[model samples]
Target: MKKIIQNFGTIVLIFLSSFLFSQNTNSSFEIKNSSFLLNGKPFTIYSGEMHYPRVPQEYWKHRLQMMKAMGLNTVATYVFWNYHEESPGKWNFSGEKDLKKFIKTAQEVGLYVIIRPGPYVCAEWEFGGYPWWLQKNKNLEIRTDNKAFLDECEKYITQLTKQIVPLQIDHGGPIIMVQAENEFGSYVEQRKEISLEQHRKYSYKIKDMLLKHGITVPLFTSDSSFYFVGGSIKGALPTANGENNVDVLKKSVDEYHGGKGPYMVAEYYPGWLDHWAEPFVKVSTEDVVKQSEIYIKNGVSFNYYMIHGGTNFAFTSGANYDKNSDIQPDLTSYDYDAPISEAGWATPKYNALRNIFQKLNNNQLPEVSKPVKVISIPEFKITKTASLFDVIEGKKSIVNNQPVTFEDLNIGSGYILYRRIFEKDEKGKLEIKGLRDYATIYINKDFVGELNRINKKYDLDIEIKKGDQLDILVENMGRINYGSEINHNLKGIISPVKINESEISRNWQMFPLPFDEFLKHNFKTKNIPENVPVIQEAEFILDETGDTFLDTRNFGKGIVFINGKNLGRYWKVGPQQTLFVPGVWLKKGKNVIQIFEQLNSNETVKTIDHPILDQLNK
Candidate 1:
């Protein structure tokens, strides 16, 4: 009797083992008439979106594990062309920018991969993910079939595919799908001059280029219903975005694919993106759950736009403007109010989604990984200060007749100073032309007023003395990320400065502040004059290093640096009061913190374990 009982248990274990093996080894991926087929069996793709560059490289595996633990079988990501190729000839595929490593880690963490390699990925990124140098080509009409733009696109695709082709499902890897041109329909709608026919040809060319460079996975295009006509390729599977109605999505994709359907909502917004001065967005969890239930029950595949919204670290955040031309600049913290918070804590939505996904499988999901440790740094004071004026004092000035733009000066990111002396005692409407973003005005070291492109402040009245020096410090808040403004988005003083009727174009002392070079040269820390842009630094010792949020509540608008690595920008505004500091960038013994404060200095900094992303300015 004992032997019979043991034999029965052994047989039951073997049967379950065989079933799990079959599930793990399914390789062939196909887009069938009704649904996706894995090894000839219907498979439902449950995906979540998280960019590799946004999450620190060290935290990549943990985040992927979190995705899988939440019952997500697939991870969707975007490859920003600008992130890999900073300059035209220069390339960076190392460290956090390693595309191959990011993909392999996803596979290792038990998740299928879907990549969107966009030469233009409008992810609220700078220039919509196009390299800034692309604008330098005067003859090239971007997002079109022009030779210059096409050539660059081909080169980027060819180089990137070399790393991706080997990972496709056909090659026994986890990659199941690759996205073709990202939302061409949306671009065509924005720029009316560029016709649908032109973009259609461009989309076809891009699709062919992807195949020529060695992409074997099934290709898909994502756009809304109105854009499907112009944004889709004939051969690629059609997918909808931002559509909440599951029935509507099925109908639209069915029509696009000739009545047969494998529906997918490529970008379902779980939380809204926040811009400066606007209230922080907190999406309704009940609404998300309701829509998700509908998608699953009706055999629809959908991916959360951002399952884990990471930090934008550095000045990589972008801005937006609508037809009204009201510019809305994005905040640095991208804590998109996702189920997995910015610091990696699991929100209530995560548990809710997990419950829904678990109902589909008989076996329990993988256990959730423990949260990454967080440490709080004691408040520290900025001991040393140096004015920006003192740093650029001896740097060579480009004596240009007209104010040169950032692209014109060949400085990709940062601030530029435009100086002009009042030749004679005259006061009129002091104005600037082509104000790219934000600027601070000064008269002979005295603060004048501010010039903001978002509010469209063109000029201000001023009273001047004969020798009163005019200084305009312009900061590139961020480029206009989407819509019709791409072609005209250049930072710094773009055109000649004018005082009422007279255009001041001669001997305009234009100084491109080289903080790196100047800081290395001298940049002595001492007693600097107040009310000027100052460079301040402080150091704190950490016994252990983990993810922490830097509190910038007391300080004014400026950038934050952690141990020489840019942590991104901070403003006194309410929405984003803290900057995420990845533990990978900190050291155990000591860590250096620096700030280039443009306004009043608090001379103090603090670190909190959690993020404060939703608070509006009080």
Candidate 2:
């Protein structure tokens, strides 16, 4: 009996030892001139760019595992400054925006992490990742040698380092390389003095800051493969932002530093984003796969722009360009036609790449998980019981001296309204100082003119003929995405009123559309307004829960929500006619549906099953 008891204790000890061995006790990657030494040998990192904030929290693990199975040695992600720290001096690193879990998950799946911690990460994101609040002070210039901007940058970097420094390669984790300001080369020449100074100072300051926070990993700054006059071209690893065909990229990279080390396609375009009226732009998946294969075959490292393009939830979606033409804002659905679509479903591109990867690696890959099933919600009715303004009435308004900008009102990323009374024959050259995107001007009840912010000038001669009130309403289409144009994202009424080109600035009433208003308003529709605004609400019951689209054909422009998870903002003037609804955000019992249509019409919302890509023209 004594012998048997001793044998049993020994067996338990053996099992415990094996468990410890299976877990990653100590792992590291070494970065030499142009190569990564993973676990002691030279390695080429085939990576893909996917942001944690963009993808849902539930899908992070599955997406990372999928990336590993696709012959990717690393997962590249952007730690968007605006995402982690929404309010200034506040920070959140969990849930869909969990930066640490995302990194650990990559390590768990046997893949390295390449972190892009940009005070200015231009992932076609709103204000290029800089928080919109910074735009409040019109005099504050970002990415410059401005003391205030640098101070804020230091604070954000210090806080972020606390979360990630420990997970880097030198610390027995998967993060091999960290990128500085993203695509800085593209903006350097344009801003010349300010750009070069900020670039140099940011590089030196951030390195010191990280080192102070105990982050000892090697760092690189991604550029446009061009040598700058005074920038830290030597300190950074030479990389191309989006140039795909290796020959063009190689020539440019080689020319930068006499052709020394490993080549990296920092951003390889997989799919383009959609605008209000444009159809879904689908890239040839075959071509992308072929190009990737070519890059690997040629011994080059490339990261897909987005391996799993996710959603831009709420007003986080950004505008692309204002190049003297159409002012195009990106749609909420960030489904970049990537390997994994926005709804966490893998596409043919994912399968094709997985199969190719298997062929190259002798079938050494993890099991592929089944795709999440699509859900459909039956028609629901949401009566618009009260307008937003009616709910918040009688409360003392936060009146401003001038028509305050969204930033001035301490508001970021949403719709804003400016209402004022103009007596008859009050004529002036109405000028808006810094209108972000689109605005609807109304004299009495008739629409006067539409201002396009991309053009950068709004001068409409107004003669208040009848009533004693003029309503100047503006919708912040979106903040600018790329270039030095980021500083111009002051939403709402930026210089609201005007008098013959001279500013009519004083005693203006600004209305901030806070998120709370969605819940505070009494939503009973018995006493509806004669002229109903575009948006309305509805209710429905469902035995089974699933994903679907709340078709907006009957209504005009607005947003829809189910169970209060903002599906996304929708505009009736489309190509993208429907908004995506995730089944998990739905209920198995009764559900509440609300719509805020832009045009004046009353119609119950009808939801139909749809994919993220197929929502165009439907």
Candidate 3:
């Protein structure tokens, strides 16, 4: 009797093992006649765009689950070329920038993947994801037949393929399709069709390269909406962008492809991104719920452009092409007023979308978690102990050569300090042309000048008295937001050292931000100055990860970072005072906090529970 029972158990175990193996090895995805097959059957994709590098690691699972609960079956992401390779042979895939982990997590939550590995993706990212260092190469004309650019692109694609190729349908993964160079035809004029043909050639080249590296998924190109009218085959999946309106989606379907195949919305708008001076945008949750319902009812597969908008962090955010009237630099916080805010909280829009998805099906949704906690610290006083001159007294490099633009100097981002020694008895008009943004002039360490964008010129005329040396500091506040001239952006002293419209020949010393140097420098404040503010450092314990706003009411204009994560610029006088720290970057243990206060010796900071968007904007 015991032997009979054992035989039955063995049979059951064998059967279960066979079923699991079959499931893992099956290619449930299929493509036929330009339609997608989900689970070996035709299925329309409801997709959303959320780059893995944009959001933090801790929130990846939560954001993916949120999308699933919002009626989206797929998540679309962009593989930023420059992000993977910061310098020429160096690659980083850890922390918030981990792409493969993000994709696998999406699959774990029952969501398919559409990878847009753009060698050139103009998603409003800095230089469209091309490394800033690439621009330094003298013989490169980005997005063209530049050998250097193409060679780098190939290397990046090869490395990325190793991570994603195995995750395709044939390998029991969620990736269904990969997009070729995004929106190429939109920029090229006159020879639109010819440009598209060129795009097709490159698209196939990338496709072949990926296949060589073992990615066998179908490839497609997102064409210009106008060009498609001339019989251009837009993306293999018959994709249309910004098709938020139901009528427009239907019209686009019939007009573009004769309404034959699956209808898809490649880019759906739920909210908008705000600039530094712009008012905080509050999107209507009702509008999102209504539009989503309409899309689903009409059998249209749509994806939110940013269901979970995350921070642009560091120098990665790109500007819009609005008219050149405003200096609308892309702000550090890419909150976007999205369904899931940059900080990763489930906003009212998330809840509304979740309810709509639940109503559409009987699928039991995952439990929604509570928001993270935020703590505030008591006010502490800070005083400046040293000046720039005192610290780098003898180590400054003086430039006697020709003046170079910031771009010419190859200084892409951050602040640059320029100092020159002026004879005490000299007085003349100190005019500086081509200044990108802001600058401050000092005569013998006494502040005597200020220049801003509204002034529209870097030339400053000042009276120079005898017995004083001249020191000037400039900051690339941000490049002008719009227009063709953006590519020529430079930070410090574009056309330097001018007196009364004529150039002044003097020994000029340049100090490029010294970010790493500052980090390693030790404080040697043996005697406290009564009026100067001190650069302070402290440590804290974070029990949870959530959105945090650093209150910089007491500190002047400068930068702050917590646990090596940049919290953005803070100014005691200006429009944005509090910096938003996304919950995902915070850890539940000891963390480092460092600050470079501008002025006003007394520095007291605290982290508040709520976002300071409304308070700061108002």
Candidate 3 overall lDDT versus native: 0.65
TM-score of each: 0.94, 0.88, 0.84
Which wins on lDDT, candidate 1 or candidate 2?
1
Q: What is the Cα-based lDDT of residue 303 in candidate 1?
A: 89
lDDT of 2: 0.70
lDDT per residue as tens, model 1, 1-618: 996876577556545743453345447899876779977899888899999888889999999989987888899999988888877777788898999899888887778899998777888888788887788889787788899999999889987898889888887678899999888888888777877788788889989999999898899999987788878788788899898887788788888887888889898888878887678998888988898898888888888989988878777888898645457788897878888888777899888888887787543566688998898998878766777777677888888778888888887777888988767887888888578778888888667788777677878998899988888888887777777777677788777677886887777888885243224324575665566777777788889998889988888888878888888888787688889898889989977788888876557889888788777875
Candidate number with the higher TM-score (1 or 2): 1
How well does candidate 1 match the true structure in TM-score terms? 0.94
CA lDDT, candidate 2, residue 68: 69
Question: Could you give the candidate ranking by TM-score, starting with the highest?
Answer: 1, 2, 3
The digit string of per-residue lDDT tens for model 3 on 1-618 reads 996776577556535643453357576666665466766677877787898877768778877877766667789998888778866789887766677788888877777899988777756566667676675677765554456767777888888888898788778877888876666545444335345556455545655566567767766555434434422344444456665666665565557665665667777778876655556667688888888888888777777888887776666666553434224555666667788776667888888888877766553444565555555544443433455545555665647543455565556666666766655456677776656556667776667767654335556678776546666666665543222434454456666577677665666677666353244445566653433223556666655555677776556666777788766666544345567777656677876677755444444557766555533432
Give each model's whole-structure lDDT: 0.82, 0.70, 0.65
* Deviation (Å) of 184 in candidate 1: 1.4
